[model samples]
Target: MATIYDVARLADVSAKTVSRVLNGDGPVGARTREAVQDAMAKLGYVPSNAARTMRSNRSGLVGLITGAITGAQESARPFGLPDLLIVQGIQRVMASRDMTLMIADTGGRADRVPHLVRTFLEHRAEGLIYVAEYHQQIRLPQVPDATPLVLVNCFDDAQSPAVLPDDRQGQHALVRRLVAAGHRRIAYLTLRADMEATPLRTAGYQDALAEAGLPFDPAIVRIGYQSDEEGEMQLLWDAIDDLLRLPEPPTVLCCGNDAMAMRVYGILRSRGVRVPDDMSVAGYDNHRIIAETLYPPLTTVELPYAAMGMKAADRLMSLIAGQGREEPAPTLVTGPVLWRDSVVERRAATLQSISL
Candidate 1:
């Protein structure tokens, strides 16, 4: 129940000075600032966010809308990497700026977003961030009176500022690496057609193949719903069977994500297929579990999830400062490929058909 007055009295400074330090409106002497901070810390002072909103008409809070924590029946926890990492990054930046975060869960239901936005607005949240369960098209809720908003990992054709991993770049980088290592017949295991990220990644894969002058064969690509790791394993096994039966089976397999790559490893091991010898594998989204658990560490792309969160927070802060929202174009962030033991060089094919 410590108030600014109590802190000022204890620190022997005026309440206005304390307020200035708290709000960062005007500069205070270092010694005075330190004294006030120490006194506030000793008194366990907590600012009333509600009162601040009432007085300033700004909550200084950013609302983050996420998908429900629990995954659907067969779906693995959607948006795991982007959700965790992006939040971490956002928190890091917000801490530095002395801001607060509010969260809402949509559970893969688009209808829930408007309610969440209204709640955030009711609470006087200064800005909003809409995060999706997966890389899918988003129909965003209209912010009341043009409230500042940003989308995370979801793009709306109507135009909205967003932060998401550059799947196309990541995919091309992955394939280019594998191709240079001598993998000509690279197989791509991807998610179903409904997902936007799937197509972007698929396009990148095709671009890589075309650049390498490798014939694009529909048979080498397998697409299925990504429900859970166990279910994906079954689908992956079936896909592997189909691929292995081909006259020219791929030596390297590029998966859509780390989870799928893990399943690929399990299926390959069960069938006595040597990793990086008989076949190599790579994937996007460097999930912590997959990176550390596999016998041979996975070579995957590290999505800048935390960075995305941090950037979103920064942009939201700008909006809250009355700077206005940026144009409604999603910002693409590129993730770097993490080289690991999962891929090996193909020494046999020195000269092959190179695409223009």
Candidate 2:
């Protein structure tokens, strides 16, 4: 392996000059910087991170604790690999930095977190990010006060700085759009009531209804899927059946996530219901694979998965730079509602009620 000294010799510069160029500590002229880079590339010289760490007193390391990749979440989320998008976003932002991300999977066990935290602390990771497979509240094993940490897709009661999806806002926006497109009597089939986002999204749904001067009708709302429960398909199907049997059936079915919407499509079709023509549908968590590939393409709300990850990384970077981790409210990131062919604009919308 070619060393800095070798690079310096090839570039016709002193070792100090080469070190300056490598670290970007003190400025070297643009031409000199270019020459040093060319020489290092020609010699296939790789800079020593350890040496750089020694000089800067920063390991340039960020530790990520996640279970999304391992599918080891508190429970299965309706969203198909949402945390994966978040992790990818974090990677995208950090990729430009001279840092390394060390990941530790909890293997679906929360107890493993402390051990992983200790391992990262031992390695002197400058910062840490904890990502959950779904949006929820969590209590992580204690980390040091000085160590910079950011929570993603989850938050705790302690009000630690976190990057989170604006569940309420996303749901509100999607519902508002549905209302705009002349959907009255929208039936909401939501995730289990226990999930953190459920209540928030429900509130958003109600908000849109109230905004449109519609009454809050709990009778039309039902649990479509449970994160902790199996046989969710039966639960979702029952909800759909219940809605269809209502005296004033909904014109549109809004699902908790794209996966559920996909299932709703099959259920509606099997029951001889034509989507959009008979009943329109909308979902949350615009998982493109499901949303775009669906028969008419789904109209859904996107959770800022990748954007949350990027924001978390940005926050972690700030924290690592000696920015005090003040106990600020969690940063809520919102995503847009994607309009697709799955929804049809009612020509003569009956404000009275919309029925399939």
Candidate 3:
């Protein structure tokens, strides 16, 4: 029921002086500041943020659209939910900037994106971020030309600015590490051929092998995972059986993700293959819950979900600041590899040219 003017009147100070004290933008004596504060407490006065937003023409609100909040379908990228990590990363940055974040969950439905977008527009969000369930190309409905938008874990045919994980680099680093540990006969079980990361990560595997002066053997690599689809388990077992039946069995097996690697462990045990003893293993997506809880623990490369979110938020903020009008090239972020007891150190890591 009270306003800044009431507090100013009771404090016997000019409205402008009271404002200076409240905003801490201009010089005000300690006694005047104390009197203003005391008057505000007495009057139970509270500043209206809505009025401030109207005056500044800045909502200080960022809109994020994702299906991760209420849970989405499990994807092959990570064994667990990665969208939550990405959202948490974005929230950290927005909070540090003193900006509010408005999130909308579509219950894992892409068809509902347009509605979320309109809701954010109605709120006058200064910037917007779209977080995908996985790394892939996306086609969005038409958004306002003036609205700054950034994509995380995905890109578009329109060449919109986006932040994506460095799939090639991450796989390359993992393979290179394997090679350095003297894993000459390493078998790779990859995601389905249709997935975007499959080709890039395969290329990385080959790159690392070539760098280590090892020959590329197609027989060792096989499609081992799909989008949690039926018949996916059969594909994995077949790949594992083929690898084991080879005359020259692999010293290590690298899987598409932590979940697959976990499955691989069980399969190998059932078939009398002891990890890091008879064979070693590696995985992608350093999902701590599965990786850390495994018997010997998992050695894997991070998917960089959190880092991608931060980069996406930063890019969106830059666009909102009017940095440029041209569509930006997708930014690539790489994550580190974690070493664990799942791998046997046949030798010290010796590859020098191998870079992540």
What does each candidate score in C-alpha RMSD? 4.6, 4.0, 4.4
Task: List the lowest-lDDT window of 10 residues for candidate 1.
Answer: 71-80
Error of 1 at 279 (Å): 0.8
TM-score of 1: 0.81
* Candidate 1: residue 138 lDDT (0-100): 73
Candidate 1 lDDT, tens digit per residue, 68-111? 34333335453236465666677788789877888777776768
Across 1-356, the per-residue lDDT of candidate 3 in tens digits comes to 99889999999999999989877779999999999999999999998767677878899999999878666454444454368899989998888888899999888788999999999988889988999877889998887888988889889987888889999999999999988787899899998788889999999999999999999999999998866645767888898999899999889999998989988898899999998798898988888988999989999999888888887877787788898557557899999999999999876443443532
Candidate 3's TM-score: 0.88
Model 1 global lDDT (CA atoms, 0 to 1): 0.79
lDDT of 1 at 118: 88
Instruction: Sort all candidates by lDDT, best to worst.
Output: 2, 3, 1
- Tell me the tens digit of each residue's lDDT in model 2 across 218-263: 9889999855435778898788888899999999999998998998
Computed on alpha carbons, the lDDT of every model, listed in order, comes to: 0.79, 0.87, 0.87
Q: Give the Å shift of residue 89 in candidate 2.
A: 0.9
